[model samples]
Target: MDSGLENIVAAETVLSDVDGQAGRLIIRGWPVETLAADKPYAAVLGLLWDGFFPELGDDAEIQAQLGRARAAAFALVGTFPMESGVVEALRTGWSLLNDSEAFDDAIAFPAAAAVFTAAAVRHGQGLPLIAPDPALSQAQDLLRMMRGTPASDAEARALDAYLATVSDHGLNASTFAARVIASTRAGLGSAVLGGISALKGPLHGGAPGPVLDMVDDIGTPDAAERWIDAALARGERLMGFGHRVYRVRDPRADALKAAVSKLPGTAGRIAFAEHIETVVLQRLARKYPNRRLETNVEFYTAVLLEALDIPREAFTAIFATGRVLGWIAHASEQIGEKRIVRPKSVYRGPVPEYA
Candidate 1:
């Protein structure tokens, strides 16, 4: 049995594909680079959900539907308590959603995901939840809600790039969890809930905050090599340097690095991160020449999200805002399948005869 299911093919999807060998990612038919650079979050969502739904419309129409859904989700902001964690608070907002089996739920889940995340960020700062503006795009509305004002064009575009860049990948852990729930004939609520739970694991979506922490620890480009060397000597896993998949550089890294670079006031941080990245790669090469532990998505994901004024604790929630679209589409894709996704296990424990 493959313990980690490495190189295992589980489910077939038309949503996205990850070519780890060549370091490429295709979402629907569009390359991730173009999606990040040229498309809005709504356009990518439209692409992913095009044929999966009965009446998925043009990009502008989809944006309108999601706007209504976001407005609907914003109505429940003050109804829920601020939980110990931001994700929990976000989940609480989603739990209030009505009609999980309805077609509107698909649109509502992502709408709610973004709205709740922005609300959670504001609540954490001892601020009130700002109501959604139906006129603004999804990215703009989210930033507006979080900041309690109009988001600049640059801020909205950067978030759009980030959300679209991470909209989907080839059957990741959270996606697999979502599909498993969907396969069990569970409704969309259960599927999305399961996805969020899997994404909360630090090994999966919790590294970005610490990537910034690493940058803060190093303080300057000159200190990067020494800091990384000392950390490596202590056997601490470098947070952003490697990935479980991606034998080459993760394609998402460059996509997000470009997005982060385009934002205003990030030039110095980008330069510093570039220096640290170079030092870390050189050291990692000298240490483990056989392994391709290059920069992964989290390396620049931290840079992008940090520059967005998003707090570390809210990163996973914000990631969920984008990925919930994938969850909904995948669940819709599995509607006709009857398989229960039961994998046989090999028991190695002492199986003595019970006379």
Candidate 2:
């Protein structure tokens, strides 16, 4: 059996598809690039929920529901103590949600839960939790919460673009984990919690934060080559270079880089990151020659998020904020299809012998 079921097709889905060789991602018939620029998070949510929640209300109603739900979640944050990491706080907040009476079959139910959970976790760390503004979009609200105030139009727009860009990819590790949990007929909250848990691992959503760490350690473009070289020699996997899906550069990398361009103060970081990218690529090409270790999504993710003033500890939580849309959509799709996702594994050890 392949560890972690690599290369396994566990479910049939009409969700997003990850074309690694082509460096493309298609979400519900739209290219990720189409949504990554200026599309509000709420709009993308509607798109992701397509064919799953046909009865979902209009944008205004959905936004109102999200705001109400977020406010409700804010009140509960005080009940769960904040000691573990942000991911743990998110998970615990979601677990507490299981007791909510308003948790019926409403479309806004899960969305609200995720927003509040993320905000509460951040708030518990003594950061102010900005209440959701019906006047703002989902991405804007997230940024507002993280920054303890309203985001500038450019900042909000950049974050919206980033969130839309990463909202979904065809059945990546976290999505797979969500689907596995959903296969048991668990609630959407449980599935999303599973997804968040999977993403918290360093190999997945946690990589972006360390990319910044790597950049900070290198301190200069001239030092990047030596730093990466030493790390490679020690057998440490470069944090932001490779991907499980894409053999080449991640398409999302370019998309996010472009999105952050419109924001002020991002230019310098972008240039520095580009220099690091060049150094890393040049060193890798000279050293390995055959291995296709190109920049993946995490490389630019660190730069952009850091420029936005997002704390490194909060990186994975923010990732979850974007990915929850995809998780909810997939969960709804799985439930509608009436399929229990079970896969058979071939046993390799000695079988029982007949006497």
Candidate 3:
């Protein structure tokens, strides 16, 4: 049995493909770069959910529906106490969704995720909770509610690109978890809850926050090389330099790095991050030439979100905000197949003795 399930093919999908050796990502017949470069977050959702939800018509209609959904999600904010971080609050918010219908959950899950995450952030800062703006795009509205003002076009676009880049990927851990729940004929809300819970694990969604920690500890461009050398010498795993799926550079990294570069007032930070990346990659190459330890999505995810003024702790929550759409879409696909996902395992333990 393959303990890690490495190189195992479990299911077929039309959503996205990860060509690890080629360092390419294709989402719904479009490259990730193309989607992130031009399309807004809602448009990506349109692509994913197309033909699945006939009720969603043009982009205008889709955006309007999402706006109303956000309003609906806002109505439920503060219903639960923020006893923990935003991710947990988001999971709770997802649980509170009464949507059993796939399309309904598709609309409500992202809406509730954004609202709950923003509300949780505000609660942590002792600031009054802000309402979702029905007139704004998902990315724009998220920033507006968090900062209590409209985000600049560049700022909104940065988040939009990030959302697009991560919207869907081939059968990832969280997506697989979501699809498993959906295969059980569970509703979309239940599937997305499973996705959110799986994403909270460090091996999945927790690295982006720690990438910021790595940058903060490195402190400066001049110090990056030495710190990386010491970290490698001590056998500490570099936070964002490698990926489990992508054997080469993560395509999402370049997509997000470009987005971060376009943001205002981030030149110095970008240059410094570039230097640290250069040093880390060079050291990694020398340390293990056979393994592809190139930079991954989490590295640039931290940079872009930090430039967006999001707190490090909220990183995973925002990732959930972007990824929830993909989860619902996958669930819808799984539900359509009418097959429950179950795999047999080898019995390695000693045979039971019978009298």
By lDDT, the best candidate is 3
Candidate numbers, best TM-score first, in rank order: 3, 1, 2
Please provide, for model 1 over 1-355, each residue's C-alpha lDDT reduced to its tens digit, 9 standing for 90 to 100: 8989976788888889888889999999899999999999889888888887877788898899889989898888789987667899877777778636567877888888878888888888989778887777999998888878787888889999989988898788998898889888778888888888999998888888999999999998888888999999998888898877788999999999999888999999999999999999998999998989999988899999888888899998988988988888888777656677788799889988988
Compose the digit string of candidate 3's lDDT tens values, residues 184-233: 97788889899989999989999988889999999988789889999999
**TM-score of every candidate relative to the true structure:** 0.97, 0.91, 0.98
List runs of model 3 lying over 4 Å from the truth.
none
Task: Using TM-score as the measure, name the better of candidate 2 and candidate 3.
Answer: 3
Model 2: which ten-residue window has the lowest total lDDT?
99-108
**Decreasing lDDT order of the candidates:** 3, 1, 2
lDDT of each: 0.86, 0.75, 0.88
lDDT of 2 by residue, 110-173 (tens): 4554465456556657665556665566666766766777788888778777788888987888
lDDT score, candidate 3, position 62: 77
lDDT comparison, 2 vs 3, better candidate: 3
- Model 1 clash count equals 0
Better of 1 and 3 by lDDT: 3
Instruction: lDDT for model 2, please.
Output: 0.75
